[model samples]
Target: MGESDLIHLDVVGLNPAIVKHEKQEKAEFSINRKCYSHLKKKTFATFVASKRISSLWHCCDEAFSDSLSIHRHVSNVHANEVDMLISAALDQMSNQSEADDSVQTSLNECQAKDASSWMPDISHLSEDKFSEGPGEVILYYRYCQIKEPRLIRDWQNELCSRLHLTGKVRVATEGINGTVGGTKTATSLYIKAMMAHPIFQVMQVEDFKTSDGGADCFPDLKVGVYKEIVPMGVDPDVISYKLAGTHLEPDEFHKEVQSLLNDGSSDSDTILLDCRNFYESKIGQFKNCLAPDIRKFSYFPDYVEKNLDLFRNKKVLMYCTGGIRCERGSAYLRSKNVCKEVYQLKGGIHKYLEKFPDGFYRGKLFVFDERYSISFNDDIISDCRYCGTPWDQYQLCSTDFCYQLVLSCTACRQKGLTACCPLCQVKGQTSSRSPTSGRVHKEECECTNSRPRIPTDTS
Candidate 1:
């Protein structure tokens, strides 16, 4: 067997017998006997003409771009030896055909084992190609009901992995929310494939918020089923998607914000209430919007209930990173009849920014990805959390276990100021010196650690 064959077996857990049979079948199907004979006649001349390693490397590189470069290098540099190896492969195939009974039994046993246990590390196959191209980033969400979230998640995960794309996909009974990054071609193809699915047929390519293609948008793909895509900690019985607020298109939202600013209408009656977490709105928000001082989406329900009087007889505008949170949040507000009208940016801040750069919305939009913020202009609306200087760069807490991000200036960062708060700073410092104290406590303001438990009858 070739080293490539051995690698296939090791990496993807392909049964050796099955791999060998498949290879033999493909070779037989693709190579015509007459053409093979003609190739044999021309092989020696071609090999002799391409005597230099550089010439051989170029030929292999051009012809076998999908396979291992090293394998191509060896095959081309040692053409005579490759011919011998081909003869041996044919002989081995003949011998393997006679042991079909034994191989069949082994194949059945291998098939019984879990396929997901041995995920192939495809980085070796496509890392070089990925590094060569600018990446396309897509952010989208849907709020339709899903009967089989897990199945959808698995299918999306496999497809994205094979396509060498990276992003996060959340599947919930209510819908799907995802953001992916890949080569422009790959992302375009992915959108087509997703739209073809019966469940997502209503989805339009125009609905997706795209970034100018770049190489460093995301690191890897992660897709899974979740109780709630946005985790707003509300019972499904309490709110329905049908009752959500009206979706204002980018241009419509822009006009409304402009009107409010132009009129100096910053009072409760004509309010733009930001539905996203405080951290997100701290960095960027629509001008004159009331961003609640909350840490998580779950708290928004209560924040709204407590501030019910503010929404009464008011036109409340809501938004988040994407529109998932607003779907339920606005619905809840409408159910209470707390506002005269509730309007949400159709595709959230992402879509709005695309249409109106440096418009009503100002500063960098914070995203929950490696590329922390996407900027539409040079506006700096925030300052370093520690130094209070005009800086908006985000840094994850230096405490090994603390994952909270803080805006820190260069001087503060250089002085080891990486914690989100004083307690976290001390915890980070203490934990570093004593590894046993590495367990990180949840931030005081955080309501719950994991996704809020799906509301139950008992509790």
Candidate 2:
């Protein structure tokens, strides 16, 4: 490989650019961090810039060798002066805007955000027989740290290649983070491979766990090279992350959860708090877990602070996706002198899923991959708010203006019920003629308050 083969454009200061990539095996991005976070916001931006000729150049000779192809591909990219990068930037802005909007809307209203994360359409995937699923492990992990950007990228590729996993990999100067999924043995073997093998030993992996239902939990694997591992994008000053905490096994932790729920016990002042985003909890959680209404992981610190007074004298049991949030959250809470004893679910919900496939937990498991959601049993968690029956499936509204995705079973779906529910019809419709006109408030439309509260965290 020549000097030109080290092809990475300095995106540190670029306003934002279209970044088109991904073939059959990759996930293409039109705009990267530099452009998307700073510039436009829309659902999908159309391709504005044309591809420059230089991008089409092939550096490899006719020799069909793998090594040569890799090296030559690098060279071609480095020397690429094509305007494709600019075009990619514009397209990304549109996609980002849509994603951002969808996420924010989903947060407050309890609805599905962008459909991008859905692997195939949810309706389609639900019908297929996932025989290789069930007990198969289905999750991934990404740890971030400061390193040479190019080195990190190489390490990511090596990590996936060595594990023989299929997904994406990205490397940036700030740090690296990604998600990859496979089967039970494959996932475990990959972890062991990363830890013991010296071939790609630079990568440090944190343990990830989920239950038997993980198969349908996440959609698919997604890897993106970001300037920061977890996308805080914060300067080193305001907050510096330190992943330090004591590790607890399943036996020791489950006892604590049990003690908290049982009354008249010596472990009286204990709090079971969940530290995950709202959607994950909607799927599955501990029976008595205290699900916090948080929209994003980054906001955990604030929730901890606000709720500190609630559990000041009590033992605080905190948890999240992996043990990532709790490791940091416990330390933060401890520092504040709020809780008497701070404990986090050792490996979060994933570990629980692995240990107790059909254990105490009840309901589906929500993940951040292509599989929208997975149920521990065959049944769904929450029902259509109006119907008051079991229903875990989600569907986007046909009405363009009411572009919301929420829980709806086949029965409710068949009714052509889009916005208002049966209950809403009762309270909303004083008279059939002008029913939806008066007395039916927006709050009446959303029955989340009345529906049995689902766990509100990923873990």
Q: Alpha carbon lDDT of residue 159, candidate 1?
A: 70
Where does candidate 1 have its weakest 10-residue lDDT segment?
450-459
Query: Which regions in candidate 1 have their CA more than 4 angstroms from the true location?
Result: 1-131, 212-216, 265-268, 444-459
Indicate which candidate wins on TM-score.
1
- Distance from true location, Cα of 243 in model 1, Å: 0.9
**C-alpha lDDT score of every prediction, in listed order:** 0.67, 0.48
Q: Candidate 1: lDDT of 452?
A: 25
CA deviation > 4 Å runs, candidate 2 = 1-146, 154-177, 182-193, 196-221, 231-244, 264-268, 377-381, 395-405, 418-459
Query: What local lDDT does model 1 show for residue 405?
Result: 74
Q: Provide the TM-score for each candidate, comma-separated.
A: 0.67, 0.53
- Give lDDT tens digits, candidate 1, residues 1-459: 443443223323433333333344424322223222323333443543353342122454454321144345655676566565455544564455454523312212322334342234444555555445667788888776666676677778877876678888998877888888888766776788777664565588887888864435677678888887778887665677767887777787787777777887435468887888776777787777778877788998898888888789998778877677888888899999868888888888888888788688877898877778888888888888677898878877776665677888999889988777666688768877876554645564232243122111110
Candidate 2 local Cα displacement, residue 130, angstroms: 17
Output the TM-score of candidate 1. 0.67
